[model samples]
Target: MARFFSRDRHGRRPLPSDGFDRALGIAHRWFLDRVGEVATIQYVTAPADMDWWRKDNTPPLISGGIGSSGQVALTLHRKFIELKYSDDGMLPERLYELLITEWAALTGKDVSEIDPEF
Candidate 1:
């Protein structure tokens, strides 16, 4: 089975600079580090409720959230990232950078780069 990691907060906040939660973050990352060694890590952008069906118009890669445009879900089987935004409040362009940074700290893997579009 695959392992997913997710963090949910209200609105937009700067990446890696989450205030206050940094205290527990240390322990959380440590746990992920160990888990990463034995399992695959699928970092999620938001908490998932397994509600992909919405209005019968949603795509497979997008998940439905309560009053949300939608949340992106990445699967390891994909070779690239396909971003489809419903709103202009797009996901930070630096998301891949954040992923690369976190991947190393949590997995001890030297992920120099990912699919550029990711």
Candidate 2:
């Protein structure tokens, strides 16, 4: 990953500036911290053209907002975080817990309800 960002199109490795190095260091640390929770991670060249088919090539049936596959997917595009779980009703609750913890840390108030800005 370092080589991916460090090298130019001609495979020349330019000396990175202090800020760029620092940003890369932080990203590496963040990735390392969450690597254990991830099942798989892939760096794609064209995400839009990427195949999202299941192994059986059948679309999961949805019933009352939940799918028959019992999978919940969470994606944080800004952080490039994607987490998928095969369960019943645990994924959203887990996300809420994370949001509440982060919100409390950012703002010293304990929020009972949060209106998502996004």
Clashes of 2: 0
Over 4 Å off, model 2 = 1-88, 110-118
TM-score of each: 0.21, 0.23
Q: After superposition on all CA atoms, what RMSD does each candidate show versus the true structure?
A: 17.0, 14.0
* Residue-wise C-alpha lDDT for candidate 1, range 80-111, written one tens digit per residue: 12244222122223333333445444435455
Task: Estimate candidate 1's RMSD in Å.
Answer: 17.0
Which ranges in model 1 have alpha carbons more than 4 Å from their true place?
A: 1-91, 113-118
For residue 35, give model 2's deviation from the true position in Å: 30
Against the unseen true structure, what C-alpha lDDT does each candidate score?
0.34, 0.34
Global CA lDDT of candidate 1, please? Answer: 0.34
